[model samples]
Target: MPGLSRRGERMPPSPIRKLVPLAEDAKRRGVRVHHVNIGQPDIESPEEFLEALRDPGTRIVPYGHSAGLWEYRDGLVEYYARFGIRVASDEIVVTTGGSEAIIFAFLALADPGDEVIVPEPFYTNYNGFAVEAGVTLVPVTCRIEDGFRLPPLSALETRITSRTRAILICNPNNPTGYVYSREELEALRDLVVERDLFLLSDEVYREFVFDGAAAHSVLHLEGIGDRGVLLDSISKRYSVCGARLGCLVTRNRDLLSAALRLGQARLCAPTLEQKAARRALDASPEYLEQVLDEYRARRDAVFEELAGIEGVLAVKPKGAFYTVVRLPVEDAEAFARWLLTDFQVEGETVMIAPAAGFYATPGLGRDEVRIAFVRKVPEMRRAMRILKLGLQAYRGAPARAGDRAGP
Candidate 1:
């Protein structure tokens, strides 16, 4: 028998979903599960989006242009204009998803074994993407103590070597929900420009900022104009995850050309989804306003509830819908599985992502889990209560008193 390829074997299972089978088993036994694991928002997709999908005017479902439909690309231009970022349709290469954009960016910018520096507790899928591209992901650990802000530029500089090709970041970062400010981005701008490296910016959660915090796009940076690649998604913005539509934007014609070639290699993104994603542009302000309000309430519910728990260390997330939580258990992954298989508060248990997979460096994030406050406020409150009670029962691993961090 032929053995499986190394890529298949090396690819790590998603920590965000690895415990889903256990969760299913719990559900089979009649345990109601509050899923706070993945960042699938419960907000409804825009009506216009559904309308686009159901249009009887459509005749054939054919492959789209390799660069995506010109109309859809133009729509993306208008979408960016609202944010004061300018890019031409030719500079945008629509991808299958933000996930595809990451892979394309890595392939376009760096060679195999070349390094890209990313902050720790980053989006876990980046590890898979790096492995697929054969690019080395170097970690620059950003402590929860610093609100998950970028470590000092000096510390970041230490990670850059001859093999370093780019620096990647996610604004309104996943897991931590730490929104990078304009000042923080500008500091990154100076460093990347000085080092003459690429800046791959994932701004999928641009509008999900909380507490009146503004998310600064890397495009807003003064320098590194040609080196910036903005990865934008319509998923969270319009609650269109199934749409699987996103685009890679860059002012550099070379990188743009390379990305388009890669797009051709994969054929094209789904034609129908691209059409539906165009409908996202038609979504009015009120839609996001209502969605934001609901998420704000959920965020407050989660923070307030977690704060009351005795030993749990939770940082208040400022953007996105997730926060990295430090649990008292020696192994957060084990505790997460135990919650699904063992503990239940009145027949309800919560599923959370063990944070260790979000880091490339081993032994980090073992004590932490990432919780998504994507449910409604009352559901979130109940989920938090389950977490509080579950922690009390799971060996009662003691944490230091008054160990809270973050603003």
Candidate 2:
């Protein structure tokens, strides 16, 4: 048998999906499972998006321009402009998804051994993308005690080295749901300029901010265009995760050209999805406003329930749909696995993502788990109830067994 390549060996499994066999086994036993593990929303996609698919207007469904369909890119120009981000349609390169947009940035901006500094506990798939691009992710730790806000710019600067090529951030971040403030964005803009590094902003959760908190885009920073790359997707924005369409927005012609070549290598993004996404871009602002309301309700429901669980510590998430929670258990992965394997409340259990794989540094996040409150409010309440009960049972089981064995 042939040995696999080093890259394949180095790849890390997704913490979000690693416990599938246990969950499947539970379901096979006729147990109900509440998924708070991944960010698959239960919201309906906008009517316009559905309508476009119902009437695709085209027969052949041929490959679009490698950059994207002209109409789709044009629609994106209008979409970004609404957010006060000005860009030419030519400057956008549509990719397979935000996942590919990230890979494009890594390939275009950094050499194989180069480093990209990111806040710790970032989107987990970033690890996979880093392996694929052969670039390193250098993490600057952020504490849940501080609600996972970006650390002081000085703290970030300490991580910079001669091989550092860029700084990446997720506005309204994943796993922690920490939204970057305007001051933080300005600080990062200055740092990137002083360090001569590219700034990649993943703004996929732009509209999911809660509590009237604002999410400032790196593209909104003055004079940062040449140094900024905006990675965006319609997946979360329109509840269209199946669409598999996203774009890389930048004003750097050199980077844009490189991304185009990569896009060409892949041929093009999905044509039917692009057409549907173009219609999605035109969805009324009210559509997003209503969606935001739903997420806000879900957030409140989950946060309130978490607060009731003794030994559970989590700051209320300000944006996005997830929160990294510190659990009472010594090993969160074990606790999460036990929920699927041994425990159930009225034949229902919850699945969660352990937080260790979201970090690059060893031994971090061993007692933490990330929960995506993407279900509706009632469902989230039920999941949180199950989570609370699971924690109680898990913590008391050993003590109870020991007491029974004693005189």
Candidate 3:
């Protein structure tokens, strides 16, 4: 048999989805599972998106321009302008998903063995993308006690080196929903300009901010067009995670040209989805406001429930649909696995993502879990109840590896 490359061997499994067999076995035994592990929202995808697919209009479902369909790119122009961002449609290169946009950004800006600094407890898939791009991730640790805010600029500067090519940030971050402020963006703008580095902002959750908080985009920084890459998606906004359509927007001529070549290699994003996304982009601001209200209610229910628990600790998230919870147990992965294999409350259990994988440094986030509030309020209430009981039972009896003790 042929062997795989070192890159293949080095790839780590997703913390969001590693324990499937045990979950399947639990279900086979008639035990219910409340899945809070991933970010798949229960909200409905926009009706306009579906209506766009009703008509083919063409004899052939053809490939679009590598830069993207003129109409779709034009729709994005209108979309960004609403956010106070000014950009030409020519500057946008539509990709397969936000996942691909991250890859393209790394490929365009960095050589092999280059570094990109990110705040710790970031999106877990970033590690996978970094490995594929042959770039190193330098983490600037942020404490949960501080609500995962960006560390001091001085702390971030200490992580920088000559090889550091970019700083990647997730606005209203995943795993830890810390929304960046205008002042923070200004600080990063100064840092990137002073250091001659690039700023890659993941703004997929731009419209999901809660508590009357607003998201500050790197593109909003004046005169930083030469050093800004905006990676965006309609997935979360419209609850169409399977759409697999996203784009990289930048005014940096060099970055734009290089990213276009990379986009050409992939050909183009899904044709039908692009059409649907165009309609999605045109959705009324009222539609988003109603959707946000639902998320805000669920967020409050989950946060309040967790707060009532004796040993569980978490800060109220200002944005996004997730929060990193500091659990009472030492090994959250073990606790997570145990919840599937051993514990059940009234024939039901909850699945959570262990937070360890969200950090690059060892032993960090060992006793934490990242929970997504993507489900309805009632389901969230039940999941939180199960979690409270699970923590109490697991703390009293820490399940050793291979121990399948029942709750």
lDDT of 2 by residue, 1-407 (tens): 99988899999888899998899999999999999999999899999999999999987889999999999999999988888989999999999989999999999999999999999988999999999999999999998888898888988899999999999999999989999889899989999999999999999999999888988888899979699999999889898898898899999999999999999999999999998998888888999999998888999999899989888899888899999999887778888998999999999999999999888888889889999988999999999999999988888776432122111
Worst 10 residues of 1 by lDDT: 398-407
What's the TM-score of each model vs. the native? 0.96, 0.97, 0.97
**186-205, model 1: which lDDT tens digit per residue?**
88888898999988999999
- Give per-residue lDDT, candidate 1, residue 253: 94
Candidate 1 residue 161 C-alpha distance from true site, Å? 1.2
Q: Give the number of the best model, judged by lDDT.
A: 2
On the 0 to 100 scale, the lDDT of residue 158 in model 1 is 94
User: By TM-score, how accurate is candidate 1?
Assistant: 0.96
The local lDDT score (0 to 100) that residue 167 gets in candidate 1 is 92
Off by over 4 Å in 1: 396-407
* lDDT-better candidate, 2 vs 3: 2
